[model samples]
Target chain A: MTENEINHIFQTWLKQHKALLFKIVRSYAFNEEDRDDLFQEIAIQVWRSVTSFKQQSAVTTWLYRVALNTAIKWTTKERKHQDRHESIDVSQHIIESHQPPDDRLAWLYEEIAQLNEVDRSLTLLLLDGFSYKEMSKILGISESNVGVKINRIKKHLTTKSEKS
Target chain B: MEFKEMKKIWDTQNDEALYVINEDALHRRIKAKKMGTKRKTSFSEVILIVSNLCAGGVVIISHLLKNSGNVAALSMGAMMMIVGAYILFMRSQRIKRDQQTDVSILGDLENAIENINYRIKLSQSMIWFCLIVIAFTMYTVLNSDKSLLNIILISGFFIIGFFMSRWEHKRFNLGKKKQLLDLKEKLINEFEM
Candidate 1:
């Protein structure tokens, strides 16, 4: 594909689906610096994936797969290089003042931060209203496994929220 | 705070711009990242191939200039070139494997594990490469001067190089491999599959 085509496709998808990227980054990365780093990594992966996207699935599904895969790998790599610091020049500011974040959303993210990496991805998919079949396809796990894990995640979140 | 209510809250952010991405900055970064990744992917491979080829070339040229058919120098130079070619081939194969875009997270994880395993194997191969260099150098040195001190110095130099590579293997490759394995285990156990 031409440079212009790739750039156009990437920009269009990114503009349309920035929320999915943001939520995945927030769930995977706790600190602001790490979040930015993870965000950039996911964006880079998504950009690379534009050329390979053959319209096999919806753009959102393809994007979720790319973002989650990048985030999961980044999380693993980050653990090894925890002390290493990176300086990203991009200004991706979280505008909490413009649209005030719900306290429950904040609590939800905190709870998500507590889950294991795979479960964290599953939780995001579950919250985003993906069906067991969709989640299984995205995660490459069995549909039965998705059902079992989603049940546990729901119960855990519900019980935790009741206490909180 | 129930699951349904939580979903309601989560869905609220769908329309709202919770994060403001700098379009210009992001575009520039993306453009730069594209170029950087292309360069970064081949950097190590290029370095290894060039260094080995150059060293081999130098040895062959020096022997030619002296008008001497030194079998050891020629053989060692040929060996180095072969090793360089092997590295070029192996690294390119690995780069291709890593670039495969598997849409599933499980496939990505398996690819990641394979990538790290390849790295660990590459580092081990470097040790074997060092041994070849050391053996060739020792043979040439003994042929020229059967001196214990000279032998010790040459062996010491390669020994230090060997240890440095081993240190790097333990410090980076092993740590990354362990983390990837742990991640894979966590995912497998989570899925109960």
Candidate 2:
């Protein structure tokens, strides 16, 4: 594909699905600096994956796969060298919305932060109403495994909410 | 709240974007990042390849210039060239393998492990190769009609190099090995569930 075509497609994806990428970034990275770094990494991955997208799967699913893969790797790599390297300057490139925060959404993100990397991803997919089949495809796991994990994640979140 | 209620909360943000992107800056950043990544890789890998080849050439030329007919120096030069060629080959294969990895989480994890393992093995090979080169270089230096002070300084340089390489391996390669093992465990455990 031509550079112009790729850039245009990337711009379209950003306009339509920036929130989805933000959700993954927030779930994986807690600090503002880390979030910025992860957001850039995921965006870059999404841009790279555009040429490979064959329309065989939904665009959202493909974006999820790219974002999640990049976020997971970024999480691992970040832990190894936290605060050691300079961060990407994302302050001007991307900024959070000024909308008021919802307590429940904050609570949900906190709970997600408590889970393992895989569980965190599963939580996002489950909450967003993705099918087990879609989650399995993005995660490269069996459908049954996705089902089992979703069940456990639901139970964990429910049990935590009851305690609160 | 039940799962349904929680899903409702999550869905509320589906239409409300959380972050705003500066389209022009993002475009510029992506372009610069792409170029920077290419330049970084070329600078590191290409420099290593060229320097190794150049070091080998210099060694061979110096020996020929002095008419020393030093077989040890000649063999060391050849070994350096071989190591450089090996690195060139391995780097190409690594790039090819990297391009083939999909965006799936499992695939990324597997690729990470493979890349780390390759690095660990390469570091091991490099350490051994350095040792051999140091030994042969020392032998050549000693047998040459050099002053006592010169021999000691050259030997001292190699010894310091030996320690530095070991230190680097311990500092970096061991951490990478641990990361590889942890990733392997994560992959296996995720699948076992």
Q: For each predicted model, how many residue pairs clash, with residues at least 3 apart or on different chains?
A: 0, 0
All candidates' TM-scores?
A: 0.68, 0.66
lDDT of 1 by residue, B1-193 (tens): 6799999988887873655775555444434433343444466568778988899988888888987687997889888888889989988787777677353332343354455456567678877887888788777888874579878887888889889878877886677567667766767776765
Q: Which candidate ranks first by lDDT, i.e. highest?
A: 2
lDDT of model 2 at residue B145?
86
DockQ of model 1, rounded to 2 decimals: 0.26
For all predictions, the C-alpha RMSD in Å is 7.5, 7.8
Please, what are the lDDT tens digits per residue for candidate 2 over residues A1-115?
8856876787789789988888898899887656766776677678778889999999999999889877777778846222333333445644365546899999999999999
Q: After the best TM-score superposition of candidate 1, give how far the Cα of residue B109 lies from its true spot, in angstroms.
A: 23
Q: Alpha-carbon error at A145 in model 2, in Å?
A: 2.3
For residue A74, give model 1's deviation from the true position in Å.
Answer: 1.9
Candidate 1, residue B95: the lDDT equals 73
- Model 2 reproduces a share of the real contacts of 0.47
lDDT of 2 by residue, B1-193 (tens): 7989999998877775555765554544444443344344445557668978999999989889988788989989988888888899988997898688654433443355466567667667777988898889888878878999999999899889888877877877686566656765785698695
